[model samples]
Target: MDEHTPLLYPSPESPAEDTNAQCTGVSGVYHRIGLRLVGSLIVDSIPVTLSYILQNSTQTVSILVTGRLGPEELSAAAFSMMLAFVTGWCIALGGGSALDTLGSQSFTGGNRPTDLSIHFQRCVILLWLLFIPVAILWAFIEPVLLAIGEPARLCKDVQAIMRILIFGAPGYIAFESLKKYLQCQGIMRASTIVLILVSPINLVLNIFFVHYTPLGMLGCPVALSITYWLCFILLILVTLLSPTHKANATWGGLQLQAAMNLKSCFGFLKLALPGILMVGTEWAAFEIVALAAGKLGELSLAAQSVIMTTDQIIATIPFSFGVVASTRVGNLLGARSAIGARNAAHASALTSVLVGSAIMTAMLAARNDFGYMFSDDEDVVRLVSQVMPLLASFQIADGLANACGGTLRGQGRQHLGAIFNIIAYYVLALPIGITLAFSTRMHLGLKGLWIGKSICFGSVRRLTHMILGQVIGLFTVGTAEYIVVWLGTNWDKEVEKSVVRNAEEAKRRTLLEQHE
Candidate 1:
């Protein structure tokens, strides 16, 4: 059998084993495993998180700049963003996760290096196809929102915002696919590097397009579209020109064959649909909360926005860690190193706790001043302060849920994560949150919503462990290979060393791509 194929073909189903015992038997070199795992995650996650944070910040900067023009401009931009988030953007986040599975595994699996290239092609085609419906849906958003009883003015403005925004859809999803494709291969720094460089350009473009050009409100989407496409283009250039990519020679020039495999396209869908739901359901639930907050009154909605925005930024830490965990597990599994995959998951959980505690502390420290960053109103600031404690608690719980979610993705069990999220947020948190948020006696508003979410997070954390245990079952894992993906990741020269070693061990690598 091809050595890399073991991950695809597991040992026969067996009797259940103690989860604690299985985790303990991870290895005698647990200390080294922990260090390596932490190092790998830090390597992959830091820059990735930074890049995404900056990217989100750049968009925020654009909005802030627009807010200066008038409240109407700001409202339209924010509403446009909300609609984009639920539709095209959700597809990007979740659908790109498919690469977290297939791309990572294909690199270490017994496939030609070109397999990664083909997989990249397949993802681009698949995501673009999925985005078509979304683009068409954008065309009709005005009437839809109006029919649903959104204010006619708000719907009219939002419609104008989306019209121009839909053109950017291709660039957005394409960037995500490429980002995941390269991330799985260890070129982690390129994203941050590109975003940092282009984000300023986006800011400048927004200014010029809005005032200096004829686009007016349409400039917002147009400038952003340009930014997204540039980010995508820059990444492709960086990957092709980088020495590490040349060393691997993973990209054969793109060809018709890259998009020809309809069968594999279906496989991508199988993995992607669950990832889509996982990210989509979470985002949707939050949007619902935003709408609920809106119903409570303008103050409540503004306060929720302030709190949620900060939380979203802080969220990058755990979300990035989960990305690290997913990539690590997928890489190890592909190399048939079950021990390594198991160790990666357990070590990541510990790392998340440590990180979560720190984030919780930071949130508490900033509670008094956090709202002022977004608003000057004393009521909004005071309201945000009341909820900061709950928000802090939610961070820790969020850490656990996201950690488990990432591991589940690595295991190619995203459907489980999706199911858990649906139950946690939709079935559990949303109902309770709405009840508390709207009750005349309770009228908890934003605090109630956050509190309910905390409960949901607890449930998600517990269920993650149970689900992980079930999927992993029993296996004798060994530290035979220590993989470090995301090539430009700042994690020592280990990845560089791996490349030199891999070149020398080409035959064996073709069979397993094992790391020493």
Candidate 2:
């Protein structure tokens, strides 16, 4: 294969490129680009969405089973699992993205087909080693939570749940590495296939362990651990035994060269650290908002909780679509097709925007009834409906930011993503949101915080630039903040009192639970 060699799937009508070679005039170019974008996104999205749905379903089953045990079990497991996700899975997702650069490039650029296999093992080893500290955190999570003033009973129960889930840490992390390995090979459907097979099995296991077995509440995590291992093992088997994998020769027995090189070790850390921080900063910030929402009145806080829960479900699409972008761009870059890589990145961005649009449309249609799924409180329902437009706006930014971040990861430029996140969220969104949340002069309540967040991404900038034929200008600051400040002028002092009330209630609950 030489520089002039055409893409393997080159368009029949064009010898130059596979994706965008059919254009003649400006209209033709845009038409071809549109077709290519939609084609590739459809190809990538289905498998990714299927896999995530199954995985989330697994979590749902565990929660539902534990919910039957008791409220304490349900809440404890949820809290512990959320923390574990932050500590373990976020790192795994970010860290595994290194392979988005390494494995993809090696697949097309290396002399040996086995390089991807070696790199996969290296990632597995590196991630497992990284999991050590996270595992330690899980072991002593009670003290850490206590030190941070978490409710005493919640702390104790979460610690126990985490200990059970800890058994799955290596498997979960290593499975992430395995998923990347297959993805780099353009084997997008494998994990989806494997998870679909395993998801039902996991539900049965959950029922047996959490409900039928004497393990009860603890059994929920145990079942999850087992499910994680199953996913890992089955993916490995797919790599080894699948007819598609037979041609790759990707699985040469593991090598220790990665372990032997300090440069390589440090290289992995350098790429992975920024990636982790990029994801960690935003997620950690969102966690803070969850904390602050309680400072609003009870009705506001309840509405916030239900809305956030629903948002989590819708959130999966953009993030998963971003994964599709990362994988697609990485593969094209690895093949050294700059044009193809650019096209893939642009297409992915478009796909995210489209997906976000779909979400917004769905939210608009569902707003009246969505809150009723969680609570019957009219205040909560009304507040949630009021915030739907803001939520819809943020969903767009979440999609675009995540998609762009994925592209950066594919290029091995995870640092850029960290910078984007730090500047966009930490330096801007968080402070803006906090100020709006606590603003007595602007009694915007929960809507203020969300408005502050959405404005950071500047939908006005995106729309203005789009209308002006300069999409690049979306990166600039927009007039949304001015709009937010002007609209937020009703001064409500009771929000501050709610903060004090919430703090007192938390302490009382903790003390009372301790006595129980």
Return the lDDT, model 1, position 419: 83
Put down candidate 2 lDDT per residue, 393-472, tens digits, no spaces.
56655677667666666667788777766776677667767787788887678977776556556543353442232123
Most lDDT-accurate candidate:
1
* 121-168: candidate 1 lDDT, tens digit per residue: 888888888888888889879889988898888888888878888878
List residue ranges in candidate 1 displaced over 4 A.
Answer: 1-32, 460-516
Task: Indicate the residue-level lDDT of 378 in model 2.
Answer: 85
For candidate 1, report its TM-score.
0.83
Question: How much lDDT does each candidate structure score?
Answer: 0.71, 0.69
User: 374 in model 1: Cα distance from truth in Å?
Assistant: 3.3
Model 1 local distance difference test score: 0.71
Clashes of 2: 0
